[model samples]
Target chain A: MASTGAVTFWRSAGMTYNAYSNICAAIVRNCLKEPYKSEAVTRETVHFTTTNWENGIQGKPVTHEIFK
Target chain B: MAMAAMRREGRRLMVISPTVSLNSTNAVRSPLVSQELSLQGTRSISTQIVRTRMKSVKNIQKITKAMKMVAASKLRGVQVRTEQSRGLWQPFSALLGDIPSMDVKRNIVITVSSDKGLCGGINTTSVKVSKAINRMNSGPEKETKYVILGEKGKVQLMRDSKKDIEVTISEIQKNPLNYTQVSCLADDILKNIEFDALKIVFNKFQSVVQFLPTVATILSPECVDAASETGGKLEGLNSYEIEGGDSKKEILQNLTEFQFSCVMFNAVLENSCSELGARVSAMDSSSRNAGDMLDRLTLAYNRTRQASITTELSEIISGAAALTG
Candidate 1:
């Protein structure tokens, strides 16, 4: 209730507090030194595979990788 | 007649090949062979059962050994991350401070559990603690709702406390855990539920073999304001001077949201590490049990085979003596 006028600049920019904080975390993670930075980055990566099924037939599997 | 009986015996032995022994059903069907061979057929059946049981135990042992190795390696990674993630939330607690115990009308219990089971009693312990909290906190004026994170807890709490569960989030442990992902989840939870106080229940990783179910509280900003007004207990806030005077409430709101995310992030990491460590030990015990079972089964199978072989040798010696007489 006390948060009316005190909304951060990011809140005014249409970002929920969640998104703003996540961005902040991402920045901090990027700024980490050397091996930790590399490990953090690697920890954020996600690689997944999917296959399309049309009717009863099979399809080739497609792999997608996410690096953040 | 003697020749015919010997030929029948010879044919029966030929049919009892290794391949036939593999199908224990062949021995089961041997009652149709003749009455005299029934005893031998049952003996072979028991031995075959023991052999197959041993094979299954061996396979299970292999699986558990592999699982133990996998959990150990995964524990190393999560344990490191959990240590680093602790830094994320410790500052917030130091700044906002812990209220210790707060009596609020509405409470949300965020139950952190794992997606997959077979780890240990980590999920059970969390569920038990959460249930106890609910039991203690329930009253006519007070209400408690559960926000279950992970499938295992949902399945458990659904049995008795299904009505108390507000939201069930799954697939969290499917991918590698990270801040961004957890933050997003926290945001969604904030939007979905409204509560005066949040009590996060998770297994705190103590060591490779030790994990304790811990409950950490995060007071909503409204509750924080009320607590400050009633008791003026937020002396920690007085220590820090704010640069922008008008934005104090805004900062608190953002900080609250950020704190929620940080605490949730750390809880998730800690719970995961505990799960992996629990898995390592559980799989290790499982493998050990399988080994013991294999040993017993091998002994039983060997004894049965030896007994059957001795019976055949004696029968052959008697037949030779009788023929000579």
Candidate 2:
């Protein structure tokens, strides 16, 4: 268990280890070199399609894109 | 009058003979039709089979080509991320010296694999390595359990060693990999199982053509303490001073968890890169083989078609000769 010491401020802030580590990783990614930084940032983008179904009839698909 | 009557009889005989010959030819034509049935029917059937086979092979070739392209592009992206993520775990590895030969009684092997297959023998290689580790570590006092990371490994490992598996985590690659996600996964594994040490099995990306299955070990804080007390590889840890006097255990636990996540993230990235690379090569070979198969099938199809055409032409010539003579 990680204690609420100065070393683990992220945990005290109600962030899980994953979230803290992800923030750290994101910071590192942002600090990368010019071309690699942009490439890494863009690579995290996800594209998916969503459609609604009502009464066995499908609606038009909508594309959703998110960057994490 | 006798000559005319004789000519009329001859004409009548000619007409009756022609009609009898036509009926006799129709009777004989049934056997020719059977011969055509046996020869041309089989020939056309074979030709149709070859044509359909060629079509399917062509479709497979197209699919493989597209897969190869997709894999190539993915490989480039993963390769870049792998290189970048190397820095994330290198410091931890330096701080926590890797003791590959360290013997631990309770071991948990985390086998890294991918959800999708067709990436050569990478999953098999990792699974084999995991099994070998289990064999090597099996003893009266030693216990080993598996925590498979992907569906590919789960399917491969479940074939024989279902009992050894502790937990199998999938969908790790469902989204783009990041340190946060890997850390969360590491946290989940830490919460679930109890182990003296964790042996992470994964494929190391050596190059575009080479992937090496590797096992990296991370020791629990207690194990680290034990190792340091024994004055072995971790002897240097005793020299470092802790700022917070009573919080040493807490600090060590945090360090161990962080190190585990870092190493796991790197392993995941490296494995993904290797998978993509392997897929690219595998699809390349598949499409090439499909092209070769298509070529052979096309040759057979053309040959059968030409044979059928030749047979039809010979039949036409023979029938015409019979009609004229």
Candidate 3:
């Protein structure tokens, strides 16, 4: 959720927030291992899934700064 | 009156000689000429049909040629980008792989494919990889869930694993896909009920000629703990230490979340590259086939025309011979 300038999110023409969050939510669930689904873990995931990330996702290809 | 008759005879002879030459050649040379006599009425229609067919084949070749060029250029762009971003996810996956899991019950798989067809068997291969993963693990019903990211994969899974498909995402192929397109899927994943681990089935772009379906697993921290706890060689675990309170768990969770997205993003890119490469080769072959078809059609057209000419000559020469004899 931090503005690390690493991840930039951009939505296409008609993509809904619910749809976007659903994908993020799926990623979190798939990555979250069992027993680690603790209260703290749930809270951390809620932060990433339900935020305004439309500022930047760098949809373009990155070749120069890849090594940096 | 005699002079006028002589002139008329010369004119008649001029037309008669060509007919005689044509019929005699067919009669003396091959039986293929006799068959032309029976088919004389259909020659015009068949030749017209052949011309239209050749035109359509030429048009299709043009389209395929354009597609191949576009796919090749797109492949070049994505391949380099995927290679650059490879470093972001490779280490995390390596660390996760070494870690073992305690609960291997719930399996969540993301099948990466493109919405577009005509790309060989890229989508089919991904679905097969997913099915193979399910079979290998012997995943139980309702326990193994699927998130399909492309229309082609969704259609394939809908028939058999319809119940297992939890979510389907689209619009990636509408533009050049990037991490942002993947973030939407990642966001959906974070809101899930529960899962032990995650796996993504994608087509790995081996080369222009070979694309192998691949699956990459995203491990949870519990699995990592399970590995280190069971003495699965915590070789480099002690090196990185967390000093803060619950932030330690929080940080690890965040890292895993980010890494998970990165892995998903990488898979999408790899799959896109494979799709384009497969299409490039697919179109290449199709265009080549069209060319071969055009060649065959042209040869047939020429043969049909020659036969029609032979039939005309046979008619003319026989008429002339009857008149003289």
Candidate 4:
């Protein structure tokens, strides 16, 4: 649960990630449309938890470069 | 992948350099235009661009703040729905957990994600997990199929596991999420798909700043029967006697349908909560960043103005001294 102060803080911030997530997600369905403009914003949302043991991001961040 | 990225970068540079070359050609050809490029003019232009940037950043901050509030407002309501829906599916999943692993003949992984993106890496994490699971299921006659909900999951999965996708649902989270819509999907899956194991990948809302992509399995009928036969968490299920001998199939079908919908609804709710939480935090950070940028821009604007004023004052002083001399 977010505090009242935090909620107030949020009332002043930027765009919802949901809107961007939606447009990106619809890339496949969009391909079904005419004159396909390859609308792929290839920015990764989050890094995966580490599977590799050495020189790997571990613990807090948990970013693993799998299938790279 | 890195090599491919480098090639793509080089291609981009190739595309961009032509414009740079064109600009240089124009500059060389036009002596009149070149004379207009004075230091004061450039300084004023820089200040103007910075001011406009600051204005845009301020506007972005306003938008982020508003989005955060909207997400915060939706959070409580969605959280309530999640709780209510979880109650509907918890027992069946708890029963499914008592069963041991088996050589799965068929498995379908359902990833529930929202259409929106700004909520950090909420959808990507679940998609990655689904991909990892798909990799494990890869063999002679790959038994794992994916039922991806929302645009985020669909687009990400389409990259690697395109062939494995069984069903893709788009425009899901447009309105308020409801049970009937989810149950309709559940019915479609139950009717069309053949599966021995059902795995749901969803973003679990832990806190305002944290979300965990989780996979929860909804056991198939075979597993349920096997577990019940061994009397593992089957006491409650066994107590309810069948009304008729022939209706066992019908009863199971209805139960499976209901259970599937319940589980799906719960997952959808969880994903929604996580998205809202993620959006709120992401927006918060964006607002802070915009503020920081505004601060830097203001500092630069003031410095440029001061330097221009000082330059003008020095010129005025030198002209007066020459006139007096």
> Ten consecutive residues with minimal summed lDDT in candidate 2 chain B?
B36-45
Candidate 2 per-residue C-alpha lDDT over B74-100 given as tens digits, one digit per residue, 9 for 90 to 100: 888889999999898888877777776
Residue B218 accuracy (lDDT) in model 3: 68
DockQ of model 2, rounded to 2 decimals: 0.11
Docking class of 1: incorrect
> Interface root mean square deviation of every model, in Å?
9.5, 10.9, 14.6, 19.7
Per candidate, chain B TM-score?
0.85, 0.86, 0.81, 0.80
List of clashing residue pairs for candidate 2 = none
Best by TM-score: 1
In model 1, where do residues sit more than 4 Å from their true spots?
Answer: A1-3, A24-68, B1-46, B323-325
After aligning candidate 2 to the native by TM-score, how far in Å is the CA of B312 from where it should be? 2.6
TM-score of each: 0.79, 0.77, 0.70, 0.68
What's the best-to-worst order under TM-score? Answer: 1, 2, 3, 4
Give model 3's DockQ, 2 decimals: 0.04
User: Compared with the true structure, what per-residue lDDT tens digits does model 4 show for residues B1-325?
Assistant: 9999999999988976775676678764344333333443663435768888989999999999999999999998898878777677777665445232444668888888777789889888999888887777657865888887877887787776666777766555655665545555565566567787788889887887888787777666655665566674654565667764424333443455557777787888899999999999999999999999999999988988898788768766865775586
> What digit string (tens of lDDT, one per residue) describes model 4 on residues A1-68?
11222232221343122222333445554565444433222221222221111122212312222110
lDDT of 1: 0.79
Q: Model 4 chain A — which ten-residue stretch has the worst lDDT?
A: A50-59
From the highest DockQ down, the ranking of the candidates is: 1, 2, 3, 4
Q: Which of 2 and 4 is the better model by TM-score?
A: 2
Alpha-carbon runs more than 4 Å astray in model 4 = A1-68, B1-46, B96-102, B230-250
Docking class of 3: incorrect
CA error at residue B230 for candidate 2, angstroms: 1.4
Lowest summed lDDT across 10 adjacent residues in model 1 chain A is found at A49-58
lDDT of 2 at A35: 83
